[model samples]
Each structure stands twice: as C-alpha cells, then as structure tokens.
Target: MADLWDGALIDAAIWHARTGDVARQFRYRALYAALPVDALEAAHLPLRPDRPGLWRLRRQDYGARDGSSLTDFIRSQLAPVGLSHCQITLVTMPCGLLHGFNPVSFWLARDDAGLRAVLAEVSNTFGESHLYLCRHPDKRVIAPGDRLSGEKLFHVSPFLPREGYYVFRFDPGPGRFGAWVDWFGKDGDLRLQTSMIGKARALTASALRRAALRHAFQPLRVTGLIHWQAVKLLLRGVRYRKKPPQLEIRRSEATAERSDV
Candidate 1:
C-alpha cells in the first residue's frame, strides 16, 4: 500500500469521525474559510433568476452560506491549512438545495488499475448498486490535469446551472493535505486520472504535519497536480417543511421594490 493511500484512509476516517463526511471536509472548510468575504458578499446573494424567465422563488434572496449556522463556526475552526480561494455556489431546488457532505461516505483509492476494484468491493460488501459507482455524487479522482477528470455529478445533473462546477488548482508540490501519490499527471493538454482517500492521514501524517508546521496552512501550490475533494451531497435537504433557512435559493423577484417600473 502507498503511504498516500494510508494517509488518505486516515484522512477519510478523520472526515467520517469528525464531520460525518466521507469526502474532504477539512480542505473544504479551509477553502471556504480562506475565500474573501467580498467574493461571497458580492456575488448576487441567492443568485436570483437573472431575467425572471425560468426560475422563481418563495422568498427573498440570500447566499446560503450567509444564513448558514456553521458560517460562524466554520469561520473560526482555526484551520491549520490555509486556502487561496474557493468558488461558493448555490442551487435552487424544489424546496432547498443540498450539500454533498451531509451524507456520510468513507474514502477509497484507485492507483494504476483504478479504484474499480475497491469500488467493486464496496458494492459487493454493502449491496450498494454498481450503477452508483458510476453516478454517485461523492466520487472524485485526482491526477495531473487541466481540469478535474472523472465522474462528476454536475456532468449528469442536467438541471444544475453551468457555473455549478468549479475546480481549485495551484502549483503542485508537498501539499497541506499530503504529497502527490504519483496518481496522475497531465499529458499534452489532457488531464490524467487516479483515485484514493483515507489512510492518507496515517501514511503522510508525519511529513505532512512537519510541512504544515513549516508552512502553516498554505496549499502545496501546483498548476497541474490536483487535490480533489470529493463529496456526496444528500438529496434529503430538498424537502422544506420546517424552515430555519436551508440551502434553498429565493428566486421570487421584487417588483414591489420600493419603486416599481
């Protein structure tokens, strides 16, 4: 087993144990916290339907993150790793939008042969549908690339907005999460592929902890190499019976805005 895989599995276990997430929440939280407040504040909170053609809302607009209870807590977790920027997005659902990490999932890996074997094991052991391995939203793969290369929910969810999918990348080196696993690299403009998680924490913890202590929260910074943060956003949030502000985007326009046209 690769050291990176060991660290990834540990990282996965940590994710599951701490955040109840199978995906990369530590980095996600760091990324989100690192984002400039202005970028979030400036982006048309709630992203009301541009011209009032297709989308409608039951309430006024506000960025989901703005209303999030975790916003303040997330803001203050004292992240050891710092984030450069993370594009925050919101989608309007029948009731409310969903977040990927709300659903619990553990990490797995795909080295040279790919994670098909590991996923197959998951399906066999859990009685999970094999089709999910192909379509589940939480799956992610990291390798050298121009853009993330693998099965992405945005690719399948035709109803999602175009900007819904964004990838964060930088110069690759010893990263805050862990060093590169030789998992992949870019070739002639095409992104390559590989997958793994969990146990990564154990394998690379010493060096990563040392580096993190040395750099103090800076990403490894690579252009082609990637730190993929896969998540499985649950569909349950779409139900909006009780309302204390879920992720739903308010699309209802304000013709009643003080002065009408």
Candidate 2:
C-alpha cells in the first residue's frame, strides 16, 4: 500500500430549514491525506509529527486512544464486525503548525473481497469525539452511495438537538472520494446536510507543497468558517442547546434500519 494519499476537497455544509426558513451554506477548498495506519512508523512519507512543514499528522490526534497505534485500534474496532486482516485507509485532514480541526474522519476497511466496513470518528468544537461503526446488516461489502445510519449519542453542534440521528452515504474510490451525511430529526425530517468531494492525487512532497501553497492555513480556515457559520445561525435566532458532558470513548452502535431520505 502507498504510504500516503494526498488530495484536495470541496467541503460544504447546508443547514436545511430546521429553525425558520433559514438555510446556510458554506464551501471551502481544503487539503486532505489518506494515510495507512501501519505507515506511521515508517519514514517514507514527507509529513511527520511535530515537524516544520506545510502539513503534518500527529499520533495523538486520532485512533481509539492518544498513545496507541492507529492500526491496532482499527483492527480492534473491526474485530467485533468479523473483519480481520483488512487494509484501512484513513481519510482525514493533516495537522500542521496551525493544527487541524476535523469535524469527522473516515476509516475505510477492506479485505480480499472488497470494502468491509467504515469507522467514522466524529468530533465537535468542544474537544469531544465519538466513533460510529457503520456496516451492512449482513456484513456485506459497502459500495458507493450505500446508505448507513447511526443513532446520535454525542453532542456535536450546539444548534442541533441531541435527540436526532445521522444518515451517511459514501462514494469511495482510488481516484476520487465523496461522503454525505444528513442529520434527521426524531420525526425523520432532514435537519442538516453535509458533504465532501475530492479528487485523489499521488502522495508526494511536490503534491503536498502545491496543495499547501494553494490552500495555505487550510486547517485554520476550516475552524474559522465553522465558527463564522455558527455566528450566522445565532444571528438568525437559532436557539443554542447546552452541550452535555464529554464522552472520550464510547462503544460503536450498529447501523439503523430505516427509510432513506
């Protein structure tokens, strides 16, 4: 497997008419890296932790725990679903000097047959995170546009209530990748929709340099945009819900069996 996969994506979020007729949409060009967990120990990639560079990934940023190897954590997470000896490609933004603020990251696990499962690590601005394990009902391989759902356990956005669920659709490929997630109310109404589409590029120093030059301070920009949008929502009279206590680690929930919106 390649040490890393570098790419760029257009990250967008749309808050549907959940509170009044207010709908807000924002788009930003961002840089992303698909790194294999096993490759973290190898010195084959240009980006490294605590290094001066355009982009870098830190070990403490992800995985089931802060100090554990990501590969081991992923394998443990997949073991419950009977997925063993599978390759995992983590699709996420890198943290450099400016640091990263990823709302979510995808871990695509595949075996000999095809894509087996996906582990989504979701986070909020409040420094809390949750993991949602999404798979087919019969352990079937997931394909592009396949629908997956999970109950809302951890609080993410203050504007969003803690009672709704999330529906996810993914389009993953070697040349490109796309993901869509929609938050639905208890009544099954779409409250918010967010999606990301990106074209893959060969992971190399040159590619990383070009992406950094094009989207300098991409991580900070992502955080800034998030807050700016929240401000806009607050101005629109959207009531903010109090954030609950943080849950550092939680068990993954099975995909919900329900109609797709």
Candidate 3:
C-alpha cells in the first residue's frame, strides 16, 4: 500500500426493522489514505484544522491524543493481542471544513505474516467514541471474507438496543475495500445490516481537489443524513433508547477468551 490514496469512493447503506421497518441509504465519494505516523508528521499534506478547501485532514481528530502520532497510539492498543510489529493503514473519510463526521473507521495492521489485527474506531453523533479490537482466533493472518464477532458495549443509535452482538466481515484488497457489519439480537436473529464498498486510487493533490469539487459538503451532508434518518425512525414509532455510559475500549469475546493469541 502507498503512503497516500485518494479518489476512493464509498457506497453505504443501512437497514433496520425494530420499529415499523424503517430503512435509509446514501452514497458518497470519499478519499482514503494510509499515512505512516512519521511520514504524516513530516509530509506536507493539505489537511488543516479549521479551513475550507478541496479536502482537509486533521491529525488531532483521530487516535487518542491531539498531537500524538496515530501509528504509536494504535501500536499500543494492539500490544495486548501479541501484535508488536506491523504497518498501520487507516481507512476513513477525510474531515471537510464544513463539518467532519466518521461513523466508523478501520485501522488495518499488517505484519510479515499478513493482516495481524484490526482496530475499529466507532463514533456517535453525541461526540463519544469507542474502540473494538478484532483478530483471528488461531493467531493466523486474517483473510478476505473472514468473520469476527464482538459484543456491543457502546451506545450508537437510539433505535437500536444496547445489548446485542456485532458480526463483522471484511474483504480488504489492493484495489478494492469492502466491509459488512451485522447486528444480531440477543436471540441470535439479525436486526440490522450495514455495509461500505469502495475502490482505491493513488493519493495526489489533483485527486483530492477533484474529490473535493465533487463532494464539497460531504461532511455536513453525512451529519444531516444521520439525524434525518434518526428522525425518520422516530416518526415511524420506533422506541427510543437512551444513551448508556460510554466505554473507552472493548475487545472481542474471542480475543478476551484466549490469552495465547
């Protein structure tokens, strides 16, 4: 993977059946990049903290600290899983000046053996964040179409209950990236399904500019869409659940069960 990748587009959708069978979907283009921490600090990218341009990426918006390197932060998070040496690549939507909203972002950790582990950062509209550590049970490299399950510990949406499990599937590749997350009820029945699929391209100034021109207010649009969907769900008579206390970190049941991996 290259240090930077632009022109990546995402087509995402969600389906829910808790309240009168409500569903909402949207499609938007976004830029994806894999910036090594050292390179990100030294390189001259167009990302700014508070400014309006084609596309801007702020370092403080991710990881744990305001000015800390993301690579180091993610490395520490993966240490408990026996993953020491690996390359971290972030797959997320860039923060635009109008507004920045990332429902979820993936941090792919690759080592000599292949994909060692994945750090999934989930954010809610209330500005709370949670992390989910996913890895294979056999300590082998994770391959495409592999499924990993984790318990739900954080509150994200009002329409969905807090108690349940999430089944995650990924199909990461050199040319395309795809992921699917299914929320299962306590009875082991499917309740909600969400997915993201996109293609990859080299990250360059021109590519960023083009993407920005095409989707200038993507961040704002995303925020609006989220709230709009929530309203739709409410109007449909879905029971609203209050947000629960936030959990800083959560590990998959499989990872927590086995200490060797």
Q: Who wins the lDDT comparison?
A: 2
Per-residue lDDT of candidate 3, residues 1-261 (tens digit): 422222233333333334124554545444454444444455544443324465666666777737566667887887777775777667777776577788888877777666767788888898877787778766687777677888888788988878777777776666677777777766676777777766556556676677778766777888887788788778877779988777655534423221111
Highest TM-score among the candidates is held by which one? 2
Better of 2 and 3 by TM-score: 2
lDDT by residue (tens digit), candidate 1, 1-261 = 323222221222111111111212232211111111223234332222322312122222222223443223222321211211221111112112211111111122233423211111111111111111111123233333323212212111111221221122211112222111111112212122222222222223354334334323222221011212211333322212221222233111111101110
Q: What is the C-alpha lDDT profile of model 2 across 1-261, one tens digit per residue?
A: 222233233233322334324666667666677766555446555555445566666667787548567777888888877885777778888764566778888887777677777888988888878888888868887878677888788898888878768888776665777777777888788777777777666666786677667666777878887889889989988888899876554756646457755
Q: In candidate 1, where is summed lDDT lowest over 10 consecutive residues?
A: 252-261
Between candidates 1 and 2, which one is better according to lDDT? 2
Q: What is the C-alpha local distance difference test score of each model?
A: 0.21, 0.71, 0.66
Clashing pairs in 3: 47-57
Number of the candidate with higher lDDT, 2 or 3: 2
Model 2, which residues run further than 4 Å from truth? 1-21, 49-52, 247-249, 254-256
Q: How accurate is candidate 1 locally (lDDT)?
A: 0.21
Models 1 onward score TM values of: 0.20, 0.87, 0.83
* Clash count for each candidate, listed in order shown: 35, 0, 1
